[model samples]
Target: MKDTLKYMGVVVVFLLSLASCTKKWEDHFGSTSAQKTLYELISENSDFSTFTDLLNKSGYAESLKASKNYTLIIPTNEAMAAAKADYDFTDTAVVKSFVGYHIINSIYNVNTGVDTVKALNMRNKYVEFTHGEFDGVVPTQSNLIASNGIYHVVGQPLKPLQNIFNLLKSKFFSTKQVEAIASFDTVHLDGETITYHTSPIWISEVRRNMTTESRKYTYFVVDDESYEAEYAKLKPYYTTAYEEGNTTRPDSTTTFFTKKAVLRDFMVEGDLSPETLAAGVVSITGTAFQLDPADIISRTKTSNGAVYRVKHLTYKLSDQIKQIKVLGIDPRGYKQNDKRGNIFFRDKRDMNGALYQDIEIYDHKVTSFYAKYRALSMTVGKYKVYGRAIMGLAGDPQTAVFTQYVHFFDPSIVAVNEPDLYKRPVFNYLGNADTRMAFEVQPLNPNEVYLGEVTQDVYGNMQLLVMCNGTGPIILEYLRFVPIIQ
Candidate 1:
């Protein structure tokens, strides 16, 4: 019994020593890098699995594995789902090609490479590819990492060679103005046909605040018959020639101009030059230019057109200002009242940080001087201003004019307490001027922020400004408000 106990003690000591040695070895070696094989990564992670399945079907799975160095852009299931809605995911060849393009043939782990390509709408310009559940992935979402490379789950595979032009055409076909220049085979240097599509872009390039980069577009002329058809639609609305001597509508019957000169410089030429379109009333910016009257009714097509970007919504003044009855307010708590009497008689106080002083405003009085007001067309809203009036209630009445404008402002200021009182108003007292403001109202998106301002003189001349502040564009219907006068 003694001998057996002594033997047991020795065995126990030996075992303890062995365990210590094992611990020491591990400490020196640190931890073995996770031996996550590529197969396991694909099989285990749903994102990778989806991608693998796609690759397999596309016959690109083996190729992906064979490549030693590659950047794999894996879209998340959510992204894939979105893509599927718009495109066909079942096509394996398409999937493989897209994956191939995304996979740069360089063996780069998460740490080895910088995020070269960017996702569609990521707040950050780029995302890194190394380490994380979804790093180094294309769509910036769920997928897994493995020894071989990264795996990402894409909702829809991308087209390998999609260009920016085609992408834009697909995204904005409804608003694009595309004309086949070939049809206008009889092209001349003179003012022959005013392609409505070309007119807005050309005019806007000169007058509107658009970057030169946006102006770089190839304008293909449309056939004569097509030009005539489009012209017939809006020509009637255009006020005929008011240029110096050769006034009245240029014989619409003529196709080519007898003389050749620049349209902008043509105004300087002899009275023989005719102004086929209205004088002085040019589009304010690209937004207000009504090149396509049909766009107001419906959104059609998805490909091809001229592209012009503008800061404010552009449409003619006739189209921008629409007349709308004051609809009951939304219970959500934004104020849209124009009670002038209360504003004039109430104690001067600040409501939501805006000065709310009751000041008497008179119409057409000596105080109300006729300023040479210019009405730039608005693209989305129906708005009208009687005449641009400066708030001359204090020293340098024009201070408020520069500080405050009657046009649209960012929508973020809408919910914020009123920053300035009566900042945007529609001047209504200008007489014999077109009083009827008309335009389509853009439906307010729940996510989009929109704010509009209109100011009125005591005589009731008013001006309005509206803008989109939130997620989407703001559409303005007819917004006309009469000042609540005593």
Candidate 2:
């Protein structure tokens, strides 16, 4: 009887021990876990030297210790390096502001196997720190797990919500004002009134073409009566900028805003321009031409009346689209006979060079699979300039000079009237690796791209003549630059 009793006692004790272990694990990451003092967490994590110093300097230590309902997204040292790729990371004020915003004064643990935090109304209460989204929040480097807190990895120092706009303006883009004479807000180009927020690619293009004088003061509708009054008030903002000496300089920020906010008041207000009003004030810069003072692209009507969004500040658009287009050239083309004046295509079976051979609409689903190399080029007659080819390679003529090449990513090519043509059928010349000269004499040279007018010929055959100067053979890849249609 005594032996039986002893065995039963052993089993009960073992069960109790297992329960305790499970409970301890759950409690480690419970809602109360983040209540530990900051000094205690920092003392254990000596590697957080820069972060700790900032916390101390900002006098955030006492505040953090006193708080119970907060979540802190701490970053490691490596995260700091990744964020400040171009700028020096040693700035004390910048680093402090960055880390400060990452910490929320709420007692929440993301590591807990639970959906949704009471703080973020995010689906399932989970906060995401991804790029191209979530402007106010950021992700940090290294996900740190502690008895009371969680840490995330970041590449750059954190910036507070207040400084977020300024930081982005300084690095990625800034705003600018664009002024033009008035006209109707709508136009049927190929079709469609492409107002509202255009793709970033198109915005970049407008920035490139704008001049200094036009960018300083942006024109918007204040009704026909207010045009003169508003223009006079806004004229002072247009003074010629200077750098060091007396040389007049261009303002970059003003030019960027002119494109980003395609319709001056699109986001802030809805469509403002209605035909009911006879004559009204409008910002210019017409279609097809960069300098013409034309019509307003977008307008909104509010209780205050009609207000148009004009490009006032400036920002340079990205040239990445040109780069992406080069990468999209069909590698399968290299396998075809492409002997002379051969039509290129995306699929080996299709050779008509269908309008969208290598290019595709910016649908995330389709493009993810179809795109290739990031850019493309060839060494035709020695000169190497980047191709700003038109959509569909519309114009190709036998007599046309070698001024452009087809960009693979976007359905476009850059061609100009080339002065020279070495052969009649536009015979193929493969990039360096193909040496047998199997492909037609491709025009673009490696490492260089052209920035001049690129037009097509009547024949629909691609042709370009360039002054190429680069060491390597030209390459081709996929990239797209959506034009800003206003």
Candidate 3:
């Protein structure tokens, strides 16, 4: 009977040890068998009930519950009420977007010494945490630990900033510019049945890229009144051709093309503020425009880009000259088929012992080289022409006499009466002994050497002609025409 009692005492001790271990684990973890996840922790907190409801409405509750290593910025019930006034929680897409902006995929532990921290939210936009604030929304408590992630209670709900397209739609409704742009439609005849859709296809193109793409862009938008005011300045010039049914009118100056040009000119390729935009902004059409302090109406930061509402926008005369690489120019202009007339000539006997492709203007039969530019849309002003050329052939004599001409279709004058502008005695080189040498040609007299000061008559077609006097073959390299914008 004594032995049986001792065995029973041993069994009791083992049971007591197991019970002690279970109590210790329960005290440390503060849960039954499993720890609370980020979603559950936020759901259980009374202050964050509004945020919990948002997660459920947005269909992110299950995602958060299943996800690991995340940080949730939960707003209080009062904060959510304020946000509900502005945001439509009934719209599932909007709710999803708003929730995505508050949740981050990575775990972020708050550092006491750090003043601010930037984290990328699930929406791919940045959410800044600064001094107990997450992107201007004050957080009441932070670093609430959970099994799957951490949660921070914020005083205000977070909203994702709209992209450029949406910003224009929301803010400029009264302007009618946004409505006119988005509502345009085009009809297509695919065989017999007519098919119609939106017109000005660029609107959809810009919208798609701004909303979905990761690339950034800067857009300058104006109200309908401002657009009309700007269009009035260009209407007188454009309407004349339309009335005459002039099919040959340059597309760049047409009413439709001009609108596209103006819109594209306002948009820059990157995110830029008015201060940075003043430095210089190049449009898609290769024109340059500047932003003045008075032009800015407002600026908004967006997820994919920035939008700047401007009072007025205009294209300035670009002093920037376009460079056409000599290598890319075609030499023969359908008039002659001679080897000497070729602008791009490949010579194997070059001094470097390698094949060389250089522009060769042979004087054998008045050979000519041409450079074309599309800067006739520029403001009426004198533009200076400059040239770089190699003086002589490898084994030929140096120096060559050449004449330069500036040919353009002057819209102000009748086609047959348009006068030819040329620079007489373009080059009177006093032969050099140095062979195969390169030199830059400058205008000795502004009147005698330039391509000629352009006038308002000039439109789009502008051509530069360099003719040899059959003196010798000249090696032409490149030419530049800089506008003298006063």
Candidate 4:
């Protein structure tokens, strides 16, 4: 009996040890067991019930229940109630957008420094995270981890700011004031062909390439009537910009110029105030216009931005479109190719800090030499013509005798009466003021030489000609046409 009892005791002790080992093994490995999901966590808190309902109505509840990682930047119920006026909770679309604004696709941590972290939200808009805060609101509570993802709580709801591009495209595109011109380029990346749309002019230039959420812009959206007014005012100057093979849209150039005229001067850098706008704003392009309080149609608030739809906006034509300056270095074609002269494009700066790019034409080896340049956007008005002709990067400026011709309407310059073709068409001496007008470029070259004043009869381009009777080289700089506002 004693021996049997000893064996029993050994077996019982062995069984106890085995049970303890099994318990420890289960505890270590079972750490992978499931816990509460992000939705469940939000559901547990009464303060987050508004967001919970939004997630459920948005159909995002099902997704958040899964094992995928997510980051929820949710606002409290009190916060939602305050912003309730801005949204219609009954609309499922609105609910979806609301929930999407709060959720991020990946796990995002709070920023530690002054630098901002632009986390893309579920709705494809950027959530600006700056110094542990997002959407200009610091989180009431944050870094709360759940089984599926992480979440942060804020006192205010987050709304993604519509960038200038988005605002311009979504709100005012129908006004026909701005066109999202699309151009595609195919690029090979690692033997794979990829294509993407190029940046439109509004985004690249007017917005100044500030595509980030950190930068704020106040876009003045012009009303349709005002847009047409500006277009009408600017159309006469852009008549000569011909678009070939576009017979269907004969006014394409005019329309494009007008659209640019409206948008280029409308965008201001910051969220300007009504008072400040009323006082007036100036564009970098030197366009100045003041807003009358009565002309403001409405002010619509955007995400950290706003769109002011206004009317009765007008600017001086000279201020709207700066004086036209054509560099002589770029010539369209020779007067006669068979009698072509040797030409060189040279660059230099004048004593007056003006650019004097030269279209040096010499060694023509012919009786007459003519180089033509097409000057577009010349309106039917008086112009003060200015010119500079000097040897660029050559030996010190020497005597250069050349006469210029400003031919309107017809660039062909068909000879009408003269028996000699070169002298007749090239000079255009048939009652044109600037035609056959001679100037000299001597060693004592002035920074700017007043060629003369000329009036444009037609609202279009002026075919400018640089002519020499084959006596000297054509050393010219630039031709500036300043409008003499009546």
Candidate 5:
């Protein structure tokens, strides 16, 4: 009995020593386990099986296995299954774009101690990490670290951000709306027909603001019903040059201008809250208007901004086409009675950040000298004529003040061509000469000097005459005709 007890004690000691030796061996070799790359971790996890398959299809799964530092965002199998409808995996380019948006080149983990970090992904798009979220997506499993970098498992896949133009195309498909938006492209017509989009007139409004992902905007788009309603509302004001000869009524430029007019003020800067929409008059233009909350059907968050699809959009004709401005440099009938070297076109930048091509007629010290501009698109309504006359050219100290009055005449009835103002070739004076219409031109830029109002009995293009009354240099920027909204 004593011999058996001693033998049992020896066996227990030997087993304990073997367990100790095994623990030490594991400690020495475990660094290889820590050397597992993010790709290795992701590929091994059953929850990320779908993501692994997508990464392999993207042809970039091998990149994640490299030694470079990165931050990968992986979605669960369920999340990937849900995202299948949103993407076309059949296209290689689409798969690559989707995968590239997820892998950031830099390392970012929760332990970095920052609540929000705006990191640039492999696709050069900004993916914002705010507390527990990534690009508006919250992580289901936060910050799992591996050898190459850290990864977060999200319930939803990160979608690449889309600018305003792409958002409009993807969300809305109305007929007139689509036609108007697409008309800005180059049209190959073999003739003397003039294309209105030769110069990008909407650089400030659409071209620069809408196409860039750097700037944020809230685009309000209407459905077909809403577009048709808005189009009909502005039909009376936006008339075509050649009528169908059916009615003296409005033929809205439904092909292009009308849709542009309707959607022009729809883009507002920054994301607006529901509170702002509830206040009404969202300040779409300078006019006070109202928006019914019930009219908004859906709102989608975009990469650059948000897109709100509404059922109704209110646009007042007066606000939409508030004024028709005839600039001196605008290629119209800027022709004078005499063609000489005295007429100089000067480009000046206004303090209001507007570019002005001013017309400065020098060496013409004679009174009654005038410059005629073809004022187009004048409807039959009273317009408050205003002129902005900058007296001096940019970088020139000659700020001489000049006095001028405008004369409106029908081009069909203009008597004759006068070579000179002092010595008449052949001419006739207009009748709407009021004292209030005269402008005392000064150096103040962007100030709209009101020059009385004119009532147009005919609805078509008319000739507007800017006649000089003083001897100083006649430096004028633009002539504007603002419709009396009432």
Candidate 6:
């Protein structure tokens, strides 16, 4: 009878211990009695009937129920109705993608004091979450803890916008512009065809930023009227090539090159607000333009970038030339030991508010460094090529002197070896206390280098080489080509 009493006591203790563990777990992870799986919660709630229907149609209800830990964001029935007015939810692929974008792969509790967080959704895109907004949609009911994960009821359905190309095609651009943008080349691979777009303007960059890159971009689009006005101003120049029998298309010149330049000048690299843009609009093309806050017609935010529509915009040729960095040139490419055993080294140094790669020549021998510049027009007239050169004091009495041989090559790829274009001196380097000196090279008699009437055969390209044989180290900062106003 004592043994039986002891067994009963042991059984009581075991039951009490098991109950204590269950209570502790419930306290730590929240009450499971009230908590239900996301699928069950959605199924049972009348408010989430629309969302439940969508999940069922998308075949995600079973998946959500089986998932261990996830955060599910569902829009209320009203939000779904509103979204259905704009979007076609009947498409299974669209529904699946839309639904997947709301289900975060990890648990995110909104009440945990996270003011802002980027949650990765099942679609692999990040859904930005704030206290009141989830992926730009306001949440009606938030932070509902479930058995497997959390749930947030949003008032607006989340839908990824069309890519930059399609977005511009539908609303912003004209039919001609859309056709040009839609132009693509097809390549066959593994018995399948793939389309590669040929739009060379900001579209490709914007598309890449939106799809592949993590970086953000701010795109400024000129209205159709403004674009047409700008094109009108450039039409004469573009038609000249066709009139002269150089190109087939009426505006091929502008359509191929100048138009792209105009578009590129409006795009900035980062997410810049209107106030920041109003201060000064600096473009990816290295040109700056002013923006009035009142001039912005509309602003739209996309997944990876933002777009602003402006009433009108203009860029100055002088501004473009001044702001343009030297093209097709690298200081590293000049670093080599030449045939005469002269060593050239290059390093980036700050010069006159700008960073320039200074190429230094160690030995006093004729070491040649060449660079090519393209897109020069006959209408621009002659240009004065100016550059900064420095001679460091070395050996003997610390006086350095050097001669720079400058030669310009026309499109024939033959160097123009005229005396007026070559054998420029560095006698100015003799007396200056500052080792770095700014200099300009022009025609000895004329005000500037006269590039004769350019033609198609000429192609308006200039390849120049500066060969220097100096007494000491010679540093060349940059070569600037400034158009001389005729």
In model 3, the worst 10-residue window by lDDT is 428-437
- Misplaced by over 4 Å in model 5 are 1-47, 62-70, 81-94, 105-126, 140-150, 159-212, 223-225, 242-254, 281-288, 324-382, 388-402, 407-449, 454-467, 475-480
Clashes of each: 55, 107, 2, 0, 0, 0
TM-scores for every candidate against the unseen true structure: 0.27, 0.28, 0.57, 0.62, 0.62, 0.66
Which pairs of residues collide in candidate 5? none
Candidates 4 and 5, the one with greater lDDT: 5
* Candidate 6 local lDDT, 23-42, one digit each (tens): 97687467652367888878
Task: Kindly report which residue stretches of model 3 are placed more than 4 angstroms away from their true locations once superposed.
Answer: 1-37, 44-46, 66-69, 107-120, 128-132, 143-150, 176-225, 234-253, 264-385, 390-449, 453-478, 481-486
lDDT, candidate 3, at 58: 86
Q: lDDT score, residue 421, model 6?
A: 42
lDDT of 5: 0.68
Query: Candidate 1's residue-wise lDDT over 71-164, tens digit each?
Result: 4566555555666655566676566554555454443433434433222211111222433322223444333344455544444554343222
Whose lDDT is greatest here?
A: 5
- Local error of candidate 1 at residue 267 (angstroms): 27
lDDT of each: 0.32, 0.33, 0.57, 0.67, 0.68, 0.56
Best candidate, TM-score-wise?
6
- Residues 177-231 of candidate 3: C-alpha lDDT, one tens digit per residue: 5653443332223434332443434554344555643567887777677777655
Which scores higher on TM-score, 1 or 6?
6
Give the worst 10-residue stretch by lDDT in candidate 6.
Answer: 443-452
RMSD of each: 20.6, 21.9, 13.6, 14.9, 14.6, 11.1
Q: Which candidate, 3 or 6, has the higher TM-score?
A: 6
What candidate 1 gets wrong by more than 4 Å, as runs, is: 1-40, 44-47, 76-83, 97-145, 151-162, 168-176, 181-486
lDDT of 4: 0.67
Q: Which has the better lDDT: candidate 2, or candidate 3?
A: 3
